[model samples]
Target: MNRFDRFLAIDWSGAMGERQRGIQIAYLDIEAGTGPVLMRLPDAKNWGRVVIKNLLMKLARADRRTLVGLDFCFSVPWPEEGPLPEGEAPLDRVEELWDLVENICSGEAHYYAGPAIRSMESAFAPYILCDRYRGDEFRFDRFRETESQLSPKPASIYHCMGAKQIGPGSFAGMRMFHALRAVNDHRIAIWPFDPIEDANVVLCEMYPSLFYQMAGLKRAYDHETIQNTLAYFHSGSPPRMSIQDEADAVISVAALRALAADPTLFSDPRRVAAAQREGWIFGLAPS
Candidate 1:
């Protein structure tokens, strides 16, 4: 197997921000024989798809493996088209999605969601814990949470949680849970989610001084600060590791994993068809 040269991470969100209210895209480039580099596009609603496609194009153009990862629900409840008949109300398609979730949690599939992480009081609660299975074995644990209510979701490529509640308990809570599960199970591999190495893969190339400036700053290393930094960039705000920087780190890790798995998924016609059959969302395409 060849080492992926191009890796892209995404910190996705549905809400709009102060400057731009749309998806956030962060890119990291790891050359076969070189170090890591970072690239980014300001905010836009469809930024997610755009960045991925552009990155792939660059990789393809250079004949490099284009790896990409995102922290979003590629599989969602099918949208309800129109209103129902007289007395009938709308139904939640979550149950259908849940069937998929069950398979993931049971380890029948490759990935699933993480349990919600709230306060310590909430984290230890039973209902909050999710079911996990490895082969015939199973374990349960509470969800993980971030400071901000709005943040990117975590992913699980290997092990995932079977949720008792619908819609990823919370954005950060369940997604981070799933990502951790994937890492622990070896379904996915990633650099440590710390600042020094993984967080600034291209720090030496871009914003070198910022990296050193943030060193030893407690807020610089805070979980909330990370997510906030991602949001800032998405909103077209100036760089501030206090919030958005950390979020990008999380997104970068996830993106690296996605790209490593199938850099050609977006380009290979056969892989696209197979992915479609597997129920992956394919709306993201380069313009």
Candidate 2:
């Protein structure tokens, strides 16, 4: 259980655009202990899904032991009773779902998952909530088993409420992860799906709210509160962090560093069998 050298936190977005302004990536070097700086694309462009993949590849090549936490679910739920094709059985693994989404969204630009979401609505609708449509099995309070284990209880990825929609990001993220893994160059390993032993880079699901709670930031929007959160992780605060997303990215990485220091962290995953397809949030035990 060696520690990762670098920790990165991705404040991801699932917006419809070539580059989403909401997307942000921040990193900290455990050894350097100086920064958790926000990353930007060249020419001041916004961060896009494709750009994120490229960055992961570059990090993998560098061979630094890195831990990346994407602010999205790595996988979705697979209920015992849900929509599926006429002959196909329920998906048993996250890797397969990643490929399925990628193939479905091949025509989608920037790995946006709009097309896939529409095309596969029937199969996943039972879990996802929409304004006009809710699957036969859909329940407003329904969420994956892993999500229910959190303290405050996270919003369901199945829920499509604006400002709370996290499902779309998972679809797009799976596509990104699939592309990174499909290269066969072995640039990355998706945690729990792939073992962490000696891997140069590993990515996992992250929820900033969990880190916020852990950092004792009772008020995330307050300037002093955000600074205190950063200070808790030994970041001591940086500049230009007036927005919530910026704080999320910076605080996330710093928290990740502090959390990773606990060698026993995530050593035993709860509900292991189910977490195989419904990925667990980082720093939480699957339930």
Among these predicted structures, which one has the highest TM-score?
2
Candidate 1 global TM-score: 0.31
Q: How many clashes in each candidate?
A: 20, 0
Candidate 2 TM-score over all chains jointly: 0.90
Q: Each model's TM-score, in the order given?
A: 0.31, 0.90
lDDT of 1 by residue, 1-287 (tens): 53554555444432222122223445444433222223444442343332333343444345444444544433321223311122333434322233334433343122222322222222222232234323221123211211011122223221234422322422321233343434333223222121121121211001111222223222244555444443432322222333453344443443343333443523442243222212232212222
Q: Which portions of model 2 miss their true places by more than 4 Å? A: 80-88, 119-122, 285-287
What would the per-residue lDDT of candidate 2 be over residues 1-287, giving only the tens digit for each residue? 43789988999988777889888888788677586778766699888888888888888889578999899988766566532444445665677778877877778888888654544444565455666566565566666667878777777766766777887887888888888877865557787677776678888888898877877666376778778888777775665766788788888888887777765555556337666667777787443
Best by lDDT: 2
